[model samples]
Target: MLRSSVHDHTVSTVPTREPRYEKKGLKAHRQLAEVQALQEAGQLDEALKKARSFVAKNKKEPAGWRNLGRVLIDTRQWAEAKRALDRANALAPDNPSTLINLSLASYHLDQFEAARSFGQQATAIEPENPLALNNLGMALIKLDDFDNAALVLRRALSVRPDLAPALSNYGAALNRLGQFSEALDVLMAALKLNKSDPYTFVNIGNSLRFLGRDSNAIDMYNQALALDPGMKEGSVNICNVYNKNNLFDASFTISSELIEREPKYVKAHSVMADSLIGLGRIDDAKAAAESVIAIEPASITAQALLVSLAARADDYDAADYLRAARRFSDLHDIYRPDVLANPADDAAKLRIGFIGGDFRRHPVGYFLKQLFTEYDRERFAFFIYHNAVEYDDLSDFFVENSAAFRNINNKLDRKVAQEIADDRLHILIDLAGYTKYTRLSALVHKPAPVQMTWLGYYASTGVSEVDYILADPYVVPDDCEAEFSEAVLRFPDSYLCFSEPDCDVPVRPAPVSENGMVTFGSFNNLNKVTDNVLALWARVLKATPGSRLMLKTMLLNRQDHRERITQRFAAEGIDLDRLILEGPSPREALLDAYNKVDIALDPFPYGGGTTSAEALWMGVPVLTKRGDRFLARMGGSIVSNVGLGDWVAEDDDDYVAKAAAFATDAAGLIDLKRGLRQRVLASPLFDGRNFARKFETLMTSAWDAYRARNDGEGR
Candidate 1:
């Protein structure tokens, strides 16, 4: 989810000065004073009239023009205020007060660069002006220069320690810098000075959300709404929190009302799309994303949603998915740094850097933990750039095992790329392609000589600067090379190396023997369970008499989500009595739940990665259909690598046949379950040491290729 910045159009106080023209400007100065009095008294219409009359009478007077600009700013007429402020600036070129007002006007008009320039000019004139520093800090936040904004806001507070606006903006900068706890302290201080400021409450909410205190964040947002009921930022923030927590029903309710109240609110549409996606309404989600694109053509959120939706659809098309990814890269192609020279010393340990946001207890973290522990430090030095807000014990493992670990969360893309380039890394690998909190834009800067994407994503990144994508023969075959923008670097065995689960849950016998009925289960994400997957499962259930299918995922915790799943199965002619729907559980419990299943069913087009590996570890044999693309073939790779090639089928009919054939032989199922774990442990899927050796060789070969190319170009 994207975070929002706070912007307020509170006009700065104009400085009092004597009239330049002793006799001719006396009337103009008196009229401007009366206008200021009316504005201070909240009679904006009368104040605007008096200010315009003053400016009309003494058009050449800078004080008259400045008074008119202040009145326009108070009335929230940003464009006219900018024009009046520009006139005042032309008359009195170095007036700090006029420049400050111009900065506020430009910020309100969405001219961030112009706002920054005006603020810079004001601060250049008066270095210790609190108002100038405050406005400049706000403009810097708008431009994603969080570090510099923090310094400027601190200087503002140093000049006037009790300045509420400066404190609020400083808290905002701290939140963007990933210092959430410090931001809370700064925001609370701002609240004590001015309890009625809605923007301060919103900033506090942002800090709470980033700190993983969702309920507290919601309460803060409610406080903001209570103070100003029509505040769009607070409402959108509440919707975002609900979506992140998988409370799609609540999110849908709020976002739908927001859209009705304001038709062209782009953030409302984006959150509405996320709600629809969580609710498993794919078509509605696509339409909502399209609505966002129509309203704001260059919205990166909308383009990324289209790409994810295409990859997860029932009728998955490789060409359409690639096009969507390409469109995202095109829109995100804002930074392109000059290529740096390759490393001069060939014998130095290759500096390999991995950049991603999933350094916590995520699938990417699990897979990477084993590789980090097994990497040969003699030939390589690992640098970790973590871009996530949350961290756990697994995150600590990454930091302890790496030579250098840098926390780059919430930093600007160009800044991150520059830091990576400064590290002098020989190779930089991206673990996140287009997922949330991705730094793919940083990769566009070509910070390293060899850049590759692996593991976290399942398809082409569509970034031309990315040199390659790590895959295996089963997932990305020879014929599908044209589908990717990068070269396909195929691994000899499996593309993924499974990290054994931390907990130990003893494998139990097949549930078929105890219940006298087979239970086929799938614990993949509900978003991957398209109508096609459901229909195929329905066919398998029909083929085997008295067989049941179990569906488990985090989304099933919601009553609406459970009902949606039940309704979809009923539409496929599957009875409710034969279905087992479950929600999330603890790690050990989740692993133990597989004890009740005889066969694990994998979803199509986007098959399971970590989920499939877990099912095998629990001794449940997975039956997956072979597919034509990388995402669709993940299950095939896992199943084939673990010496269970017979469990993989060629097509839908073959899949049903295999499921029926496997379930009909009760004794055979029992025998397979008893030895499945040991079988997987002995196969290449569980051979982490060998996998690391192959990985090292592959990376060294890629570096050699990069050096060859650079030598040919005489770089």
Candidate 2:
């Protein structure tokens, strides 16, 4: 085998040693070419290794270390790059390129101070270098030296107009400084230069969202997601669009989906709670709100939702809700002082702030419509803080006369507080007590120093912060003073003084149906129709065998709910066919439905307010049984005030007797109906100016008392 392998020639290989100068020259040329080739190919890792090898072999070559640092930057080995670049600078102390590389590496590692020093050195060496200027600007931005960042970025852009990164970074600086419109233009230009930049699009959206172009912001989010679907921020932003538009169900669906992926996401749960509340799923809303509180104990959303839930349930455990509310109030605090001198001060000219959600066609509005119309603008300034979304004709009058009217519909409590403080209000009244959309948090924040909860809510807020709750002798009996958060302030005849609008309908002289079955009507919310109320109503129907009970409410608008109500009445030994369940009707139709009812049956525990008034206006007397609480006596109060004391029953037994007697006394009933409208029209209950004057007197008294209590404190 050895003889056959003669061609292998293992005997003849001699190691060649060349002259030192020639070998060194050849090696130097080869190393330089390798470094240049790797750098040109953008193989920074391989290039760094090659350059480092060359530096090790030839320690005197500054170019080798400089190239190595540049390669380190490409690999983002910023610290190592800084060291190598520093070595190159030391070896050749005046090289602008070496100084620039050192600055770049420092900037990449977020060492803005060191980066700025090296950048200054580079610019000092070659003051007009566009790359160096751009690098300096970016470092300034990273350091949050936004003013300086703007100056340097503009300089760089002036030197090199096509620099996309510098333009985009400059736009962000403008955005940080609140020049959103200009920033939008610059960011848009950056996008035009480089269309696929996700950050630029996100920044553009951020500016748009800030400007309240929420739909445009949503479109921008969609565009960003289209470019990169994994943008979680964009997804959250899209959900916010649903929130802003009041498409709460859509928002909830998106939030629920997000929760599946991130179960403890606090913002998602918060949005879910809001959406659920909008959908009227209060129990589910409570659960979602609890989840938010569990995740973030100090979250404002959680605290506010819990407050709302307690208010809605009519169970104010005040401790937590009150404390949080006080904290918020302290932050947004405002106080009122008499601006005019004592002699010049006109009690008639004090500023009045009205806070509520129902300036629309609601119970609170019905009572105040005439008062606001006759508020005597020459004597007082008025401000309204409306919390609800819906509005009607009466709302326009409030808007027109009020010195300032703020629709604080979607604003947070803090923002609302700030606005109130800005207004420098004198007297603040809470027209909405515990009703839905009543921002108790804003009241807690103490936007105004003198605050009173009045009118709309019957029960005490159970928060000691309130100064008073407006009532009358009938609604606030002297014995029940302990039930109030504020001192009980009573009007002369009634707490609710109706302001009669020109909506007059002529009284129908004849009976609704002498031939038709004797019909009883109740127009109230389903929530007010408690079990006991239903039982009493059932007794009224049973007492008159042929009489039909017309149970009417908004809830009955839904077929399923209507069926449920019918079934419930049937279970109470009422003939289902005889129970005429009617849905919500328009105002005119509601009045028309009155003619169909021979008598009105009021709800127990929570009697009808506006409905009772409406029935009286239509000349239909209501029979109401007095209960212990204010809510239970609204009907009795209205009936008594309208000069129909006989119609105001004293108890369950009296209610049955009164209703049957009214049914049997057709001639007396006819006389009562024919003359009842005139009686109400003349009564103090419908006198708007009289009520407003009384209300003003009460407010002046409250202010006087408030000032007297704190006179020595120099408030």
Candidate 3:
């Protein structure tokens, strides 16, 4: 979950005392006291009337204006409060009381910089004022200055250890900084002091969510909502958690209700889009995302969603995806920093940094395991900048193998980029493009002289700072070069190298022989199986009689998703009896499940990557239709690398024809199945050592080019 909104504490007011005014200002002091009393009594209208009368009589006195601002704040009139506060500040420059009120008013007006300035002035004047420090910290938090916010909040806490508001804000800063455990501790302390503080509960929920305790996080959010039923952040956060966990129905329900209540809620619309994407409702997802864009034109999340959706749309090709990606890039234009200097030495050990948020049992992690384990560390120093809170054994492997491993989950994009720039990496590779928790924003800072995007994401990042994209000749053909924003650096054979599965599950014989029928399956995410892919699969099932298509993915765990898939397939003239839909399973079970299939049907426009490799590893030949873009061509790359290019089809007709013909040849099918695993294992696709050598060579080549360019420019 992203950082939850911080609810500022009630504005602190100073005692109204006229030390400067003598006997002549006695009446003014009395009037100020009366206004303060009325404001304290919550009679804001009466207080405002009295304050206006006092201000009108003593137009030059800062006390009257300050009292007026305080009453305006009590009435939630932020703009007028700011005006009055500004008047008071102009009258009594550097007055701690007036400055504090100005800070609060500015913060409410969304003038965070002004708020910070006022807070700084107040803190400078009264060094140990808890209210000044607390307000300063809150403003810093709004500005994504968590490091400074944490420091200021720490000072506030030191001044008054039981300052619950300071404690809550400090916990929020800790959460953003990626110190979930410490954040939880601080927030829990705050909760003890003020159980009814809804924002504290939300902050605690964020910490729990970051710690991978989704259920506990949900409970915390519920606690927050229970305290304040009108807390939109708490409701939106719960929807976010539900979406993350693939509870699309729940997320959709909550987001829908939120939209009904408040149609302009951008976060709710964004989560609704996420839920729609998970449910394979791409068109609806696009609409939801468009709604977000309409509401917030510069929404990075919505633009990124459109990029992914366009890539998956059959009607939308690479050009459309690029357009969407570039729009997403536009949102980060403000974040772009000056390019860091190139490394001076040409022959030194090239320090290569890999930045992403998926070094924990994800497909990206699996793909990188072999490379990390087998790469020539002597020639290239590896640096891992992990940007996620969750880490498992795979993460440990990365840490153990890398020269330096930093968990940058808590740092802001600019700080992460600065850290990377400070590291002076020769080449930095972005493993995530626009995926969740992506650190792609760091790449915009141009932290390294040579930056490229490789695995994890299929399409071009459209980030101008990204110099190249790792590809193979098959996945990125010459004709498609124009589609990518980055220069394509093609490998000789396959761009990816699969790690041999650790499990020793023996490949079973073709299921067609035992069952007297062909069992075609696809274990990739349902979202990848677009409407066109489904219709094509339906045709394949129709062409091959007595065939069953087994579709298993995480989304199938939801009954609504299963029904949706069944309905879509039924509309394509496929019967329910011939379809087999199953939910996710353990890795071992998933691999073993492939034994029941004779052939695997790969989805198009966004074909399987790890799933395709896994299918081949399980002796199931993946029948893939070639596509125009990298996302659609991955299956062809994998299958061709395995010397089974015949399984790759040119179009829908060819796909159905291949499936039908392959099923008819029962003997050939069994023999192919028996030898498929060995074929893949012996091919370049599984050659980790070979892939590492080529990878290192490419890195060296790219670095050499970078140096040559810089030298030509006299850098």
Candidate 4:
């Protein structure tokens, strides 16, 4: 193969020429025109034959070789087209068309860098070449250089506003940058240019999904698939919609077909994992995620799925999976606030900051409530930066106690970071990981100097700048330190210290003396009740014959959802008559329902958190299996911290046995329930002041280390 001119930086131009009037030149030009018309007519084979004949007769004409390359490109023979384009460019070093053909050939072969180089040369030679600019932008998109991709496409649009390719790809760049609304507008403009473009429809679907218009997005995806039945992205997105709508059966069927057709399709596998999780196939979900990891070892989506699956499976290796997910993806950077703070400030109290959207009756809020109530105002100033629009009554507590409270609901991450920095916070902590409603990308903008991740997540953040994860020895052992992106900073006792609501329910002195039926209850979210959980619960109910299990959760609020859950359990040999499901009741009424439950049966894998705490607070003993991840070990953590280790089971068998034991030993169970509330109240978990002191100590130590290193810089 001939090599093109080695002018890497400079653009190649088409040499200016007038038609030569000689007979041979006239005949050659006529043959080239005939071949070009054939190529445009989609008769690539005929075009190639005619081009080869012209090349044989007119061996010195570069146009003949360029025409052959264009034909090869049409046939998707990229490697052969590259060779022909190379020879064409070598023969006529300044041919813009030859350079452009080479760029297209490289693009088809997935050689984005080479394609970009040739595209740059083509655009430089013909500054108004919209095709060349569009090519450059597409290459940049593949390379994840969205900023420059946007710049190049904008230039392309400037030259040709109706450039469909430019608009479509520019919209994709916008999507990558998280500008979904703008991406939708750009994609709509592209659709107007060519209504038949299936790619634009897919892009529009992506933007709409991100903007929370999932139903409309599903319609767009369906339309794209209808337009081009073989579109893989649309197929995967359609499956995603099914999972989002809680239609796991449909999602699993579609994803199974997708896996068979494209075994290495990572996104499809991730979707399959979610569908499997919903179907109550924990092992299958784990396998699907493992398949994704096999294909792309560093895939963030795969690792996240694996973490959730492992947690839900109640697997002993769940914590390791969480660590692996963290290692595989850099979730977010921990800001080092001390670096950005003024030195020689030892005399003043340290300013601590909490950044997250979950300060409103959420799990993060439940854990953080104690922090605010117990924090020593004289020694430290608290700064709470809320990023969410909604706030519950609990937010009032954070506001009343915090030294500086800022509602940054509508502000972007950069602006939020500036506000935190302006407060001169010594330690900035991230409560939200990569979970939903989390603004993690804001930390990527480097808002603070010392940012760390704590509660509200169980996986690695995949962020490089994030400093550490506040944990306990039980949560992150010393040997497992290497698995985390951030350093594992072990705290004393428990990582999370629970705060008992001052308005605790009055404990009934007498437990129900009735014994004919055993009441089983769980107050966790409906999403946590996987198929495996229902199956296990069914087994327990079967073992304890004549006993009815009462399942209380908010999802049971809808009669249809209750029936669906009931039907699923019935299929596992649990009769609908044996299962009593209840909707969400008022707080006090819900607490009173604990009297009806002899023993609280916790869900496996992704176990209970606030629900478990509330159950114990209601003087109900919860039977739970110890798990590796936070979601799995909620009961274990709360029970152990509250001095109820006997209630914490080590495995599934143990959990079942404990439940049965509680049923057999009615008197003992009643006694345990009566003293449960008192035990929890007496434990250190309820001592908010002590927990706050420990949290403060950890933050100050980290800040002091940052300051000492900076202080010794001149020495």
Candidate 5:
């Protein structure tokens, strides 16, 4: 019912009361001690009554009100504590203890800036006050000033080494700075001081998660939950861990549990959407995200997920996706930093800023491996703005190779954008599109002279600030220009560039000759393999007698999903025996799946981009049909760029015919498979050097146009 721990002259608890003291000075002080003793004895109501009487009697002195404020703070009545503290401050203008109590009340009320200011005033009056110093450091950490927090916290620890709250706050600051190991060490020290602190365990879990120790992080989360079952942060964090582990069902279950308990927990709703997306339920994920937006219209988390769902839709509309995207972007306007120089600097050396979350081993990183490493150093100075949640070898490669790499991962989006603007980048490229954990909002500031979206997203970002979407002539044709917010900036050859993977596993020949049956496979995400795409694949299988269709994805592993997929195929007259379903595999094993597929089936309305590139590189010919928008036409662009025009079918009828024809002709399959990798290597699609040159030239052209448009405008 009450929380207080006595520690002699150290002033562990402050007891606030009214002016009812009959005696002055010494007797009034004795009355304050009596109130604190009553509180410590767990008689909070009796203590509060006595404090009120004392305050009512001794209205001339601030001590009665000070003691009352302290007792209110102990009861967690933050607003009431502030009222008492304000009275105490009015009576005793420079009392250090009253100032400290005022700061404590503000801290409990979540008024961090006010807390810091009061703590500063207290410290100035009594420079040796460890309590004030620790309070100020805690407020600094809350404000995300990790460096200043550490400094202030160190000063507090110097005065009182065993302060558990200071240690915990400092550790949290270290975790935010990405110093996980040191954070863990400091957190352990805090745990030693106060083993029952559930929040310390949550901070420990966060550090462990960031350090890639997922199992340990989960263990720490459990420890926190065991101590405090109602801890919202612990519940949400463990759910996030499950989502990251691809245990979507578990994540959804936990989030649902949280929702049932506290329906207004919008963060849980955002996590639920991520779980739905991972489960291959794009429509359900979209609904979940929309619900969060309904609750919190400006929620960036939900807005980004909504955009991701639109981008991943079976019937993706670039115009529709753009409109959805601007809803998120327009929520806050980012002012152009005053430091932005005149257009006179447009003629200066190229300074490029590439911002995104996937500067790690994700799809965006896999695609940019060649460019980040080989983009001509003398011509372009890179400022890689990495907003990463995790790290891998590719992350290091980009950071090490770039002229300057700033990890603005934990920084606010607008502030991070201003940092980019301060870099004076001539070309700012958003590699993350509308995907999760993106800086598309930052681009709204127009940080650089030339802003473009490329590689990461296939569709147009609705923001008018984005100048162009890098494309090949085949990808964004003249007819598709009106659907896009950005102008189509096409390359002479292809936009789908490739570099040799770190693993150059030898390519095997077509599976048709040995197996006696041509196998059609699509290793793309199951969400992309819509019902219509499945029906077409079924048609191809029925037309080509004795052929098998091998489908592999993370979803295929789930028994429920596997059965659903089987039933869906059976409804189309395709036997379960003819369908070979597979699930998640190791990287090398996934590449080996290409050896089993004679022809790769590119899923439509949302076809493959990286999957198609990988299929061709692994010596499997991908048959793709042209479609309306950028996402649908990725396969067409990839295949046509590698000089496989015959493989690009015109319609659904033509698609089935091509698959059947290609299956029957084993000789042609073998010939195409054998020569495919080399053809890709020689073509513009896989030419890294040529790709670098052309991309640089294109960037230069964009810069020149920016200069021409704003010749006199210094923006």
Candidate 6:
């Protein structure tokens, strides 16, 4: 087994040979011909030996240096090849052949810009040259300029229609640009010219994978590996397809093998991180993300992953993650403010925009119905910019409710930002704040006059372009504003406004009386049930005699999560029989599970938002231990808003006491359950009519504040 990597900084600074450039004599040319003959006979090492001897003997001939460079390239000695080519170019500075080989060596060395420069110089010297054009296009593709790469490669094919390399590279460029059908056509053309090209097969697999043809993509990747067993590109694509199919174990196997083969392979480490997360190994996922950051300091995605994992537990405060979020500010440090089309405009029409990833069957979508449907249509022209692929009935409702809807899933962040600016939105609201598949980078351009973040995240997003965070007095207090990057825009009662769930299930009487033993439960995400939260829940169960805890989550289906939960409880002296772990079920069945419990428990520091509301709506009162941060206090706000502030505990002792008291008072529990839904319906949490008015006022105020700031009339 071997683990190693090749990086751009590992190349030697000193030249491996003497620097000389001149076509010396006919003797040098004849020696070069002999070296070429050995290379053409499939003897790269022999050719390298002969070329080195020729260059050492004829030290002044540029032709000898060029021949040595060609042999070095064939031998896969990129650094030495670059040095030889550098010496050749120093002597014969105008030779297209020297420049072309220099570009090839640079490409192998991962010096993409240098390769493009050398290839461009060669093309300038010899117009309509297929070799130079194809090399330049491939270099641009490596640099992620896919649109121009496709154009350049197409021009190269026009000069030499049957050039297989150009066709293959063109297909890769189109595939990257999301033109999968066109890429397949170009790749098939390339395959007809060269049937054994492994990379062309990998590119075709990539196109198929992006087109959602996972089974076909896997077959193509296997074909690529069959042609070249050592091709990492094909293996990496296979791992990606496995992940797409939710086969995390298979993804882990292939990615781990790639990592063992090359420890510093960045893509392999990233894929491994995703696999780790899917398997519910938070600690391992964090470590994998850290490894990526150690390899490349500019990896914002890895940093985001680490922060999100830390936030799931009580490992750090909001201020800590808030500062970490500022790392993404460097992504567009050179961006200057563009003159707006509606600069210092009047308030005849206030256009508001909401951009998010989860406009589907998620908590954000559940809460967005009122805000989108109940807006004052004449006062505000609402727009939606969806950044995700998930679309369902609620998503269609959002589209129907809004004045305009645009799907920006395939657009680049900067391009989406520019389009938002073109739409002349007065206030752009971000519903996806660092959540999965969010386009947080788009807000860096500050497309609207005012930008606010809401719903998707619980704490400060730390993006400087976000002017405000829509919160409530209970969630974010006046003193906590210093910790946030954005201004804390407050609502009087609660920041949340949710509609009812789809279940017709009604609250039942206390289950404690029927079962003769209290059953406490938590329906929050398994990841939020951190070690600290689990330890606290153990104490609650211990305080209540004969009480059992019911934990249900999607991860409970995995044996690992179930085993881990059992081990944690064992440390607390709690029996495995007292714990009921259930996997995911249908929506109606999940809501019905609350009937089996007397009370629900909320995890600390990252408490439930929708889970708490749903539990209250289902006649199960949740006891949450309040903390200092917004995420920790979300349960408190919801309970306080629902007229049951006593259910939210002030500390750990209070939490355990509340759970015991609620479980023992069977009569009071029955009474609370019977009237729980009506209580919530009467509270501000589900009062969509009042929430809509307040939201409209908030947007109107934000617009006025923006106009005042721009007009030099400070608010």
Writing each residue's lDDT as its tens digit, candidate 4 over 1-715 gives 0000000011111212223312346767788888878987878889889988887877677777887887777777889989988988888885777777788778767688998998899889987787788887877776656678789989989998987877888887777666778989998898888777677787888778768788898898888878978776787887777776667778888888988988977777877887776655678877887897799776545655555454445445635665654553454333333233322245377777788778877778878898888788788888888865446788887889888777665354555666676776666788867544455556665555567888877645656667788887656657657656777776776777666755656766434456556778888767678776777788788777777788887657667678889889879988888888898887778888887887888886777777777787888888887765655655676677887788878876777777777777778777887788888777666667778878888987887677686783210
Output the better candidate (2/6) by TM-score: 6
| TM-score, every prediction | 0.95, 0.60, 0.94, 0.72, 0.87, 0.84
The best candidate by lDDT is: 1
Ranking by TM-score: 1, 3, 5, 6, 4, 2
Would you give me the overall lDDT of model 1? 0.85
Candidate 2: segments with Cα more than 4 A from true spot? 1-348, 501-504, 509-513, 649-654, 712-715
lDDT of 6 by residue, 1-715 (tens): 0011111011111112223434456776667777787887888888888899998887767878888898888788999989988998897796888887888889878799999999899889976877778888878777766667888888889999998888888888877665778989988898898888778788888777777788988898889889988777777778777765556778889989988998887778878887777665678878888888888777656766765666554566666776677765555555536433332255456788899878878999888887776778777788889876557898899888887888776466667788898888888899877666556678877888788999888767777788999999888878888878899888889899888887798677778868888899998777667677888899988998799999987778778768988998999888999899998778788888999888889987878887888888898888887778877878888999998888889888888888888888888888888888898988889888899899888877776777676784322
User: Who is ahead in TM-score, 3 or 4?
Assistant: 3
lDDT of each: 0.85, 0.69, 0.84, 0.72, 0.78, 0.78
Estimate, for each residue in 1-715, the C-alpha lDDT of model 5 and write its tens digit: 0000000001122322333533568877898889877877878888788888998998866777877877777777889988988998997787777788778778766688998898899889877667777777767666656677778778877887888877777787777777889989988998898888777888888888888898998898889889979876777788778877777889889988988897876777777887877776778878877788788787666777777677667777677877887776676554434233222264345888888878886777877888776788878888888776577887898888887988887665557767887887788889887776577767777777778999888777877778888998787888778877888898888886776667767788888878788999999888677778889999999999999999988878888778988999999999999988999888778887888999999988778877888889999989999887777788888888888889999899999999999999999898888888888888887888888899999988887777678773432
Alpha-carbon shift of residue 7 in model 6 (angstroms): 18
Per-residue CA lDDT of model 1 for 371-472, tens digit only, reads: 888989999889989887778999999989998989998687778888888888888899977666578878888888789999988789888889999999
Give the least accurate 10-residue stretch of model 2, judged by summed lDDT: 1-10
Clash count per candidate: 0, 1, 2, 28, 18, 1
Measured by TM-score, how close is model 3 to the native structure?
0.94
Clashing pairs in 1: none
Cα error, candidate 2, residue 269 (Å): 7.9
